[model samples]
Target chain A: MSDNQSSGPLVWLGTVLATCITLYLFQGILWLVVPILLSIILYYVTEPLVYRLTHHGWSRESAAGLVMGGLVLLLLAITAVTLPRFASKVTTWNEQKIISNYVQHGADFVESTLRTVEKYVPFIDEYMMSKARDNANWDEQLAKWAADNSSHTIMGLLHWIPSLLLIPYLTYFILVDGSQFKRFLVRAIPNAYFEKSLLLLHRIDDQVRRYFQGLMALTVIDAACLGIGLKLMGISGAFVLGLVIAVLSWIPYVGSIVGCLLVVLVAATDYASQTWMTYGAVALFLGVRLLDDFVFMPMTIGRSLQIHPVVTVLMIFVGGAVSGISGLLLVMPVLGVMMVLGQILGQLATNDRLTARYQFRKALLRARAQKGLEA
Target chain B: MLFSLGKKKNPRLAQLKGVSLFNDLKLSQLRIVNSLLHERNYLESELIFDQGDEGQALYIVASGKVRTHRDNQPEDKFVEFGPGDFFGELALLEDAPRSTSARAVEDTVLLALFRTEFLALLELHSSIGSMISYALARDLSRKLRKAIVSNENPTNL
Candidate 1:
């Protein structure tokens, strides 16, 4: 008993070390797995469209081909058209607008703030100048850090490029052969738990599908409202602002706030004299958010998801910590899927009280029918 | 109970997969049936049809529960059905009165298609009829198993 007790700590330590090593060794493989998982989810989301076309008497292969072909064409067109336009827009913004305005306003604000501070503490100006010197010299430190980090940085990029390439390829195959993949997955599960596992998987899949579709719908509504509101407010770059808001909305609570801040800042910079316009921009975001909470979210996404705001926020943080922006956007859906899986698994594990009730009702009916025959 | 032997109309209606009769329908037949599906919704406790009502459309529960009952049956004798389960199919296929009255157990959603839809499905894809029949057979077998188990322990209640 003493020996066993003494070995317990050792055993746990060994287990922890083994886990760490295994994770380290398999990190690249895990990176590769992300695109595969992402592609599978994308396939499920897109499959209904293909299925609809096929259902209309089109051949399965033909339907898949047509949809895939159209998607490719659309992507090619967007890349060809949008990429150059976006680049030129960025260039124009940088050359014509960005540097001069930002520097002028920023310099004025800094000078005023420093003057106020120096009025209180005469030595504060010297202290601030030293701080400014430190900031101005930050690039040297960054350069040194970059030199030190070069090997790891290159390695990380090399690691990521293959995973990035895998996404499109994986999505393509998943789109083409998703049914076969499902069959393969189902076959891999043990027979004893096959039915329950399949049911749980299907439930999770359904939840993800509905949540994603609802999110897409909500994104569109958000973009439309934000665009129209901004346009009505006579805000320049309404389309870009709306696009940013729509994309950011995927990040949940923080996303909208960030978009609001950007809009407010832009409004402040654009119409500094017309302060009311800044207030209007803030009001617009707040109003839309209220509408989202009261009507849009409930109508589009349903209250059944019932995720707590705190948990939603925490998940966003955890997701960002784990995988940056993509993780932040996807974490809620991942949590949603996990919640559904937990519910279904719980139901499966529970004693069949409802099924028992069903059985009892069936028996009572059967006995009464037999008695009627005898009479 | 009208069914015509003509080409389909409104392709979008038949394209959805969750309709009760067409849940397992082949892609080829779905295009045919897509023209035949009629979507309908009901409030809580609404009666879809009486047991003796002429059955026209086979009903598929989309988003809510439904209850089916035969006339002269005890109140507790109704069978509860949920999403993906369907009823009134027998009448649609056989051109007869409904075997059971269907009531919305909750705020219910349903997708229905008439005899023409099934006929269109049948004409377009021969495999679907057999697939439905096979599924129904398997479902009946499962029900029979439950019935047998209950019969063995009636006194257990």
Candidate 2:
């Protein structure tokens, strides 16, 4: 392989190892960083509004305060209306024999699908009912496991609370002192790289801002479409389903799958005809996913970001592994910043600037030559 | 335009400390700016300044927003100015006529610094002159880059 091909894998492996080591070593600091990360993401999304407000004669503080207040109000509205309904539905689903129906049907589906495939492929037929037996007893084991692990989980949650608190506090300071923060960063950088750093910061900020803001708009659109469709179908818990799907959509591919599975489960358990409701739920999910992937996403983020689906999936997977759900939520923006860094690195490694300059110069020469030839 | 900065604390002026332009300046210099700022209030639909008028003060959005637009047309292209954002700087800094008229988009309060007072501060403390120039240049570059992206025409940049 050429030097570039060989170095690519080596560099990536190094990065993976380095990331793992850092996370392992500084687990405590990671908590504090999470909120700051979230806040920065929020800042990126809200900065344009701030700029607009500032342009119109509102002070930055007042604009930020208004935007933050508006955001808090929005969150409160969602909590007040949606939370109780969501909890009630979850509780009912657990209590009303729905869980047993789901597990039985799920196991049946798995067995049937495996058997059909095993007829051709034979070796994979090792998937037996023994796995279902093991899972049937899973709840009994789970209670014991929870009894043993509850303390650790609680401790971890407690550990995370402080970090969560720190994040919002950090965010407030970041917002209040954002200008000074920028100046401090700029001055800290040597003058030679100041312009490039500023440009990089602006690009990263813009990409992140657009991704988050566009996603927020898309979530509303998705939820509205899904909720309306479900309501039209007279499906119970359509609003909850819609809200769940909208939030899940942020997690990329697997998130959507989970949302679809949940909707299907609800439809299957709640309605009389499993077949029709299954079909309806599947069609609804597929239709919305199609519309989003084909139409809305393209018009909004895909066009601006130009990220490929394969890359998007892989990034989401890596992000999931690294920081769990939060990582998945943030992966796209992080990838955007990384991609920008990658391009710069690629340029440096290949010394591609001369080639770019030459190409442009060649175009100019060709235009001049064509003009002379015409004359 | 001159207003005294007494021992009484002002929240709006205190917030000015966070802005980059005033970040490096001494507290005393900020006190000077506070003294120079005049509190101006306007009703809805009131014109703060008109296009082609010499901008006499850099207006900071104190409590409400203002709308900026060019000479009369169908729709006013509003760049909503709110708290902590300073405008009329283009005219104030360049000594040019206002590029667009600033009208109170709502019932608004503004902190205004007269051009003469601003000039006098720069005259007294020349360091601010360079700082303001640097800040403007930086801001203009950012705006230009943003315009390039939004307009989808890099050649314009």
Candidate 3:
């Protein structure tokens, strides 16, 4: 919640350059990065409980172990209770070819809409609609794009599963030994820069904590809004659907589209006799999305990770030009963190007193190291 | 000195136990606390910190001596700290400017316990944190009482 301190222009330039390069690299080693990202989230999610246990007189190891142990037990219990029922339902659904039925229902809605549109405007039916269509080049581009993207989604999920399984193990160590690792890193900083480094680290840690906490609050609000609206509108399992969509929205742009499309599909199939229900569902989704952008977002995530509207807009375009989709999605959070790092580094670079002390410490240390080794 | 507890073979841990702030911590906890400290050396008469500098650490004299006095006021003296003694304890509790400047009275090695790391220790291991906090509070109480008594009798000096 603390506003990031001001830094020099050089720092801002460095921050942008660093963010672009990091986003570019993330596109390559996504396998490693994905699990690390998930683990960090899981770490943040469970850290407060561990801290609570430590406050009650447990050592870090015991507290972390107990917390993670309870988590594993809860997960296993959920799996044990749900997996058999899920398997049975999936088998029954597959026999009915429910997926194709849903697709058919969606197609029916599209066809009816088209027919209605044709009534209002003649030459809109299939026969003369071909005359209104563009050319071979556009069709070819659409076909090529579909072919390129079609198989990757399934393959990408498969590729990430094994890595995703590493989240719990990684998160556990981060909970238990994270402080020790921090100490190890701190030990490497020379004493001249030590206090400043620690201060910066504390500030960064607080910022990150607030950011994640805000994210969780957003998820709860979004789920409650969507769930209650859909339930009131007579959708079955609406709360669960809303929860899934809210969680999916955590992944940024791609997730939002997929989640919206999924809800539209469910609404279409579930109320095949009432095409109006599907229309209402779509309308509801858009309204929630609008509110998310204009209100909920500012109240939650935006409050913690504040950026100037102008800089955010500019960096978005720059991010798109440099690294494409991932950059566009990640630039904001990366900028948030980079702003803090730059502020601290800028302060260090400009502090003549600290620089003098650093030089003295280094010279003194070097002389001590070389004292008996001289020829 | 008699209550000081640590294995004699590990001199660094032993030295940490000698400091009142860390005296009550177990050997294992002391090691954890010890790892958070940064070591620095200062030549005789070298400035450790300025009067107005943002205080971020409590500096404990590991060897030699240190003097605290106001900047540019030769007659204004606060206190002198020798080996096993610490100055700048207030920095651990909050972010504030130093009330007095510190300089090495002799070639000195200091173990600096920074606020951020110490606070992390407080979160992760409260017993170690509470022990040190108690020591700091007790020391501050003593200083306050002394100041009050001194004010009551100006000739006590």
Q: Sort the predicted structures by lDDT, highest score first.
A: 3, 2, 1
True contacts kept of 1: 0.00
Candidate 1 chain A least-lDDT 10 residues: A1-10
lDDT of 3 by residue, A17-55 (tens): 888788787778767776787677778878888888877
List runs of model 1 lying over 4 Å from the truth: A1-41, A91-169, A322-327, A341-375, B1-131, B134-157
TM per candidate: 0.53, 0.54, 0.78
Best model per DockQ: 3
In order of TM-score, best first, we have: 3, 2, 1
Q: Where in model 2 is the C-alpha error above 4 Å?
A: A1-30, A80-172, A303-308, A318-333, A341-375, B1-157
Better of 1 and 3 by lDDT: 3
Q: For all the models shown, what interface RMSD does each have? A: 15.3, 20.2, 6.1
What's the lDDT of the predicted structure labeled candidate 2? 0.63
Across all candidates, the chain A TM-score values are 0.65, 0.68, 0.76
Which lDDT tens digits does candidate 2 get at residues A1-375?
A: 021232255445454454444444434466655677778867767777766775566665687877777876787798799778865755565455445565444444444544556677766635564465456666445434544554555457667765665544455556656645554444454322322334445555566668778877888889999999888887777886898898888777888889887776666555544456656877998999999989988776765666668867886777778766656666665565555555434433453432453354456447656875653
Candidate 2 local lDDT, B1-157, one digit each (tens) = 0222344666755776765556666665576566555566655565676676544557777778888877754464556787777777764566566777777777777776556556655655567656655765676677678987788333222
